[model samples]
Target: MGGNLQAEPGGIASFSISVRNTGNTVAQHKLTCASGHGWPVELGPSQSSTIDFEPLDILEFLPMQVRLRIPPVTNGSPPAGEVDMITCTVTSSNDPTFSHSEYANVTVSELKVFSTELFDLQGNPVGPEASALPITVETGETVNVSMSITNIGNIEIPLSVKLQSANTDWGMYLVYDGVIEYDRVTFNLLPGHSTTVQVTAIIPLSTFDGSQNAFSLTTRLDEVGTNQFITNGTNFLVGKLLGLSLESSGEKVQATVGAWSQYSLWLNNTGNGALNLNWSTAEPPPGWQFGIDSAPKSIDKLVSSEVSFGVIAPNLAAVGDIEQSIRVRVIGTYYNDSVEVFIDLELTVVPTLHFGLELAPETSVHDLPRETQGQIVVIINNLGNSPGGGNLSAIIVDGEGVEDPEWSLQYEHSFDELQPGEEISVIISVTPTADAGSGLRTVEITILGQADEGVIVTTSEVLSLGVTAESSTTAFDLSSIVSTEVFFSIVVLIPIILFVVVRRMRSSAKIYDDEGESLVAPGVHTSQENISERRAAALMEDVEKEDDVISGDISQFEIQAALVQSIGDLPPPGPAPLPTGLPPAGLPPVVLPPAVMPPAAAFSSSPATTAQDITVNIDDNAAQGGVIGSEQSSSEPMPEAGQQNVAIAGMPPVPPTGLPPGWSLEQWRHYGAEWLQRHSGK
Candidate 1:
């Protein structure tokens, strides 16, 4: 048998083989088939390795079918274009060399199969076939991957390669040989051949830690209507990134010498992970101190913590603005690297002055009498940051706003400089004169200082110092008399003196006209000269009767004396004759000796002329210049004793007494004249 057959992988190759009894007849023959490629071959329907045929059955040409199986690709199938031959043998059962053989050919066709593998640039397998593990990479790092694609098919094909990424912002590319292919690459591959491709992936810095991304390589035939063949992807894990920040609100700080100052700083974790941190500060200059508070050992992402730094300058540090540098270092608790921040701070020191003035508690006020001296104590303090220089002044001010020439105020206390927290006392001797008379006064005390900036600082306090009217040296001060008894005596004596003055005033008011007639009431019956003559004659008759009895009473003598004195002062009646045997009307009366007169006999006899016989007139000479009562004419008959004179026209009724209190004869005469004229009918 000679035949040709074709089969695909894992398919069957079938053909027919012919055998004839060309040898002597009636003998039995056996049939058998062998494959050249060691594949299984079957000869007949019995499916035995060898089959026997009879001579009668082989009389004519016998036809037999042979079947050959092609091997699968996974089981080591032959390559494309390879051929396999099958040989069938016919032999006599009894003879070993009496056989005839026939051959057939089997050809393998094209079979399409593919495989892929992945690895890093260092040849570490990281593909699906190798457990499909993910690749870990840090942010901002580049990764190179190798992709190997194998064609396990029986024929050649055009293949294309492409790289894909899960994120658009990630940079990915495909490469062939040594040249870069932007998105995809194409090439031809023979059966059972393999090719390598490079995949580049650039991780961006903005990627977050622990974020997952994927990159895949797709391989397919470059043919129309071909679906995507194979896609092998691997995950990219983003590693953790650590970040830190240190800052403050201000760089410069103010401080004074020998004083502690504190500053604040903010420490923040700005990265995408938690961190354990330690902080420290640099050493300070000589004689300066620096300190820092305990900081947090662990911090979470996006969290902030506050830290404090304290500093102090030495006592001898220079004044004015000074600068200092401070450095802060922060280190990770798990790492050795550190971050540093610097700050330049300023410290200020200047001279200042503050003054305080206070009066001593016990000596705040003084009660000084007139013509006496007193002392006032004032306390002054320098309440400032530095040394100060100034002067002190004091003055006495009267609350009543009265200035006295005899008042004196003197003090001698001054200083050129004074240190801080120092105090001093000053005495101001105040002497008030006798004329600086009484009431409240004040001692104004002031202290002034100058600062380094030429600014004035002053303080003042007002103290009360009273001046009493009492005098220490003067024995008797009339001005100091304030007794209730003396006041009452002065008030009672004033009315008695006023009464005497009023009586004398009335006596001086008498008036006489040119004819010696008193300027009395116009309707008066008597003239002033006639009344004087009647009074003188009546007084002389009383004295003569007393002399006949020779009364020794001193009261009678006093009466005679008073009569003598009163009549002697009156002007002599004008050109009138003297009554016979009587003394001249102007002559003074004779007074008997006191030894000859007896007190009991003086008032024993009652004279014919009583006090009622006498008539009196009152006058206000300053206003009217006339008396206010009536008088009898020289031709009128004399009224008898114990009888009143006849009532004249317009004359008022007179009192029984000679004169009323505070009334004079002239005033009574003028008034009586006017009264008689108005009441002439009555």
Candidate 2:
């Protein structure tokens, strides 16, 4: 068996193990050891050792050894008997195997830490219970408070303090009194570093307080973790009261024109506040005017208490030194008063005039006929600022500047003083010879000195004296005359010649027949009736034919005859007899039925019709067939039979009244020519 050891009850146990190798071939051997108590055990190779066992927990112990291969020892001792049975092995080359095994024990402890510090401005330490300061103030007082904090801990501490007031009615309060909101800064503090903060508080008179008011301040540290601190200040007592007053300076007094006199007043603030005021004025005298100036007047805001503005007039007897009074009242919070002021003024009366003049009957005669009487009117006027009264006289002068004895007529009247704007009148009549030529005459008026000497004497400008001749035949003067013999001679001779020539032409063309019956050319008789119808055709064919030529010759003869006679003698002598017989040779016959013939023609044929027949038969066929007379044939075409019939059809039927047998062609031609000339011209 292998080496074994046992311990007796209540006794210690020891064991030894040995091994050797002496071969030249360098042999090796191993040794092992174990404990029955379960305590850690060790083994050795090629060495002898003894082991002792201690009972770990009151249990039996034994030692055992086993053999195992081992390398030779280098000269050092092996591990002790307390071996590490539960070994921590590392496979990495970076770790070493345990030569001996042991374990270490560890213990942990926690300590309290702080990040920020607290202190007062005077370097006084501020405890966690200290928060803010309290102070007392008056109505207008201001307060300032300053504070500082330090990093009391091993590490830097960040801190902030908030200040508040218990009473909001206090005018104003501040922390860091002079520091603006935007200028307050947050800072990082190093260990042992301290920062100072200022806070201010204010109380106003409006603050109502009999007791102290309290406010709180909090200081926080290391805002991240649960490290914080808080503090509060004691109550501050505040007490104050305010008072104010207002006054007014009366307005500047002024006046102007109105329906009647008027005045105005203004209440100006002259003290620290606004003011209300009352005002009034005195009545002015009659006819005197006054009014208030529209704009309000002001006074220095620091001086006068109240003022009055208005216009006034004193008693009439005091006009020399008239005075106006203005009343004013000051209505202010703490003051009330009234005052009257006098304004000096003077009354000035302006003079005026309204005067005019009126003349009695307003009319006068300048010049009259030799045996007629002429009259003159003189009106005196007091048209001035004063009355006028005086004696008046009148005188007349001829155009030659000689005073007429008859014009020496004088009219004097006693008159009362004419009031301003009054009038007076005076009259004077005179007789003068009507032989006065057409020229201006003068009427002098004089007023003897009575009311106003300067305006007394006066005279009118020249007056016209119209003189007319008498109605006697001797005064009618003829400017031109001619011998009655010459006048009558012309009057009788010219008419007779015209009459004789006209009668001769007519008698030469008078119709006479075998039976003495007159036959007027229908063409000549109806010419007037046919004028309008014939004019258009005639103008187209024979504008310059013999009928027109004869008309032109006749007009020339008339002009020559007019030159021989005066403009007064050109009307025809009398109405010509209507021709009743035929027209001269080469003219168309005019038929006369018994019903159209006169009673005289009923007994005998008219010479005009008989002659017209003879002339018509000679040229009727030729004329009816478009044969104009040899003289006009070259320039005019004869009318066709149809056109001639149309022309005849347009003629007016003859009236029942007919001409006598004595009528002639010349008369018919004259009447026809006159009618044709008038119609053509039209």
After superposition, the stretches of candidate 1 with alpha carbons farther than 4 Å from their true spots are 1-4, 9-12, 16-27, 36-65, 69-79, 94-98, 120-124, 127-131, 224-228, 240-682
TM-score of each: 0.32, 0.19
Number of the predicted model whose TM-score against the real structure is largest: 1
**lDDT comparing candidate 1 with the true structure:** 0.60
What is each predicted model's overall lDDT from 0 to 1?
A: 0.60, 0.37
**lDDT, model 1, position 192:** 69
The stretch of ten residues in a row with the least summed lDDT in candidate 1 is 589-598
Per-residue lDDT over 569-671 for candidate 2, one digit per residue giving the tens place of the 0 to 100 score: 2233475224344343333433321112223332333221211111111123332333222111112322322121111121221112222233222332223
lDDT string for model 1 (597-654, tens) is: 2122212222222322343222223123221222232243322333433222223333
- Model 2, position 395, has a per-residue lDDT of 61
Question: What lDDT score goes with residue 387 in model 1?
Answer: 69
